[model samples]
Target: MDAVSKENEVRLRKGTSLNERLVLAGIAVILCLIALPGLAHLANGQWLGIAALFALLFGCLLLGAALFERNVVWIITPGEILIGEQRPFGKLHRRLIRDDEVSGMRLRKSIGKSVEFTLVFETESKDTLTSPPLPDITQVRKTTLQIAWLLQLPAPELAENPLDAANPRIRLGKPISFKRVRAYRALVVLLACSLSLPFIYALWSGKLSALGIAVWSLGAIMAFVLIRYLYRTSAFWIVHDGAIRFERLSLKGTTETDTVSGDDVEAIDVESGGRKDSLYVITIRLRTGKKIRSPPLAGKDQTHAVQAEIIRRLRLNSSGDA
Candidate 1:
């Protein structure tokens, strides 16, 4: 801790969250898979055709929201900035930013969708650093201004509305959103409903004989496959200052959590450089012979950047090379 960090009152901040909702919903979905179809006709589930379709589709959204709620927040102190996930269910992946490293501060407009300005920090050597996306809210804006004052950098200016089309701010680096895309959810929900309706109609009309039951069972399997896809698609990594945390939960009620210190990570790797979506993935191999992978992120550059930064920090923090 330094004088600046010591003088600053420690505070934590976050945006509107979907944390517990996802956890509980995902848990319910997990339990539903256990003999629900065999015990009850197609899980007796009107839920899937109408109500539950959205649930399966938005599985990634909920997972991402939960990760954001529990982990994705900023903790500011006078001497340093703390970043990463902060929650009991999430491994606390905290990165400490010293006052001396930050050479400047600026407000930047993000790329794509509704543009929003977020606080960015420049290193002494002029390398740019960014925090999680921030909307044009008062508290974070105030904090950014205060940090600029403390760092003796050019203060970040306000943009009209970062989420608006009129955002006239400098754009930098690969953009990331705190939430998943809405279109993916919508698409999934549509598919689920398409699969579910025929079975529901057949059952309601009492036309679902043994043959119909067999058809419904097959449909049920497909729905599970889709749900599992969504669940696994939600997998991702949160890069902390000196550590990394990966979350992988399947639709089958199985979860794997890995919190690896910088010293333990052997390397970071990315695949499908030019591709997007599920085809693009990031992998981190640890010294312990375990390899962790990330879901499809925006682009290869972003993955590579995060990987390089983590590996660099890990090497710096560790006595041996990464």
Candidate 2:
């Protein structure tokens, strides 16, 4: 048997659940009903409503099957790793890994802090496969590490917050720092500036209304809204020790910690961009396979130190020499 098939024999469990499918179907039905009104005029709305009702009934049946079915496994074992979506309509998301095409897995962040550890592999074809939305936190994290290790990839350096593992149920404190806005807020600011430019030029060149004071007032409102939106987008945060903290601000506030054990963490990585005046970006790959990246705006020194600390911890825990 191939390695994948062997691994499947050892680790594959019936992971799928009927209840999960029912839930997905139910959600889909709800969406369909929501769209029924918009399409109602096409068939006097009768067909749309009937279609939505049928969908809802089908969802209920699937839910019922999920609630009572035991022989049906929630998770299916494909030769390769596939993410079984919790929703009913979800099909198996297959992942195909080739032996020679494999590269080391690394934990990285994508847009909007959707933290994930990606298995790096080189293939002649540029197609990519992403697992469906993960089912749970622990499973996701565990999967990231397992896949990385299997491919002989360096585990991403992730920060450990003992308090988070000790008390996952409670909300841990976040750093209230401006540096937190580094990643997302920076994008927002750039977009805002881009949007405001034409408008500002229009006002300045007298091409549009410099008419009443409303022009200036409207300009101010637009600027304010853009600034505020940028602020909100910059709100990426992380929890450490006993505090919930924001990256840009220096103040540490108290919050309840979660109950997850520290040993549960799977992978962590720190990344920084730019050489001169480089910004620090810290990414925590959780046991759930979900990764979170702290925004770069948090200041260079602080991020570097945090990265070092995380690397130190990972090195200590790791069996290989640093």
Candidate 3:
């Protein structure tokens, strides 16, 4: 990541590092090499070989995409702010926001850690233009200040207001539970097994040399690791009786629970990309300055609903004590 400033304009650019790109390119090359043997099996009309070949090629394509990931760039001038993503093919997808349209800018931190931050431009129309997540908040803050000065806008500050919960309380007749099950883990296991099929076949057919055996061994280990990841125990959240509970079920059938009482709750805030379908992180702030966050929940409506109910329960508890 680097920034360049000139008399008329300032430019900020960020992308994958050279070492990261080289690693992805190397993996892509290996996948292509693995696909070569599967090509010969295509003439034999073998279904397994065909599936393996497709999987290998698909993996290569995915790696290639990673190797040439789109680079994010921001150009700030006296009149307007331009945000663009430069693709590997030299195509740029850009958006322009004139100075008149932007009301202010703010920095927002992600739920889990303060390291990840986003710079958001608030428009007069209630719409927002947000920068990609950047790990260094200091850098983001500096860039935000520079842009605000260039655009003649207010200095950016951290956005930390709690989400409004003044709507009618939502009654929960029973405990609300949210389960965490990542479907992507299963997809990864499937892909790993598919990529290993050809090597397994080659070994079974006694056509594998010493080098082939090593590659097959590595594939087997990778498949095992992915399978384990797919079946790993997961945690869930339960909101009930004026408290939020986190429970994790272990593979050995043991369950652990931790609870946070509503009495200590200070506020309920949400972090998101300001989109209806964007993932929302609901954070519970305590009087002690502690924060308990829910896992990334999909959709604005669902997350806001949960937030409202939690606030409702907290109020009910406070009223009862009075």
- Per-residue lDDT for 1-322 in model 1, tens only? 0012223543444443355556655775564454243333335655445444444445545555545445356666665777766664557777777778887777776656223346788777777766655532223455566666655567767654421212222112223332342345557768878877887898899887898788778776776666556555555555555666666654554555667787687667777634545345556677888877665544443444444555554554322347
* Candidate 2 local lDDT, residue 247: 36
Rank order (by TM-score, best first): 3, 1, 2
Which has the better TM-score: candidate 2, or candidate 3? Answer: 3
Candidate 1 off by > 4 Å? 1-106, 113-153, 158-194, 199-216, 248-256, 273-279, 316-321
Clashes of each: 9, 50, 0
Assess candidate 1 and give its lDDT: 0.56
What lDDT tens digits, residue by residue, belong to model 2 across residues 103-155? Answer: 33334333233222233334346544433222222233455455545445556
lDDT per model vs. reference: 0.56, 0.44, 0.65
- Regions of candidate 2 where Cα sits further than 4 Å from its true position: 1-20, 23-113, 118-218, 225-322
lDDT of 3 at 100: 93
Candidate 3 per-residue lDDT, tens place, 197-259, comes to 887798789887899888878887876675555333354566664676766544443556677
Deviation (Å) of 109 in candidate 2: 7.0
Models 1 onward score TM values of 0.38, 0.31, 0.39
- Displacement of the residue 265 alpha carbon in candidate 1, Å: 2.2
Report the number of the highest-lDDT candidate. 3
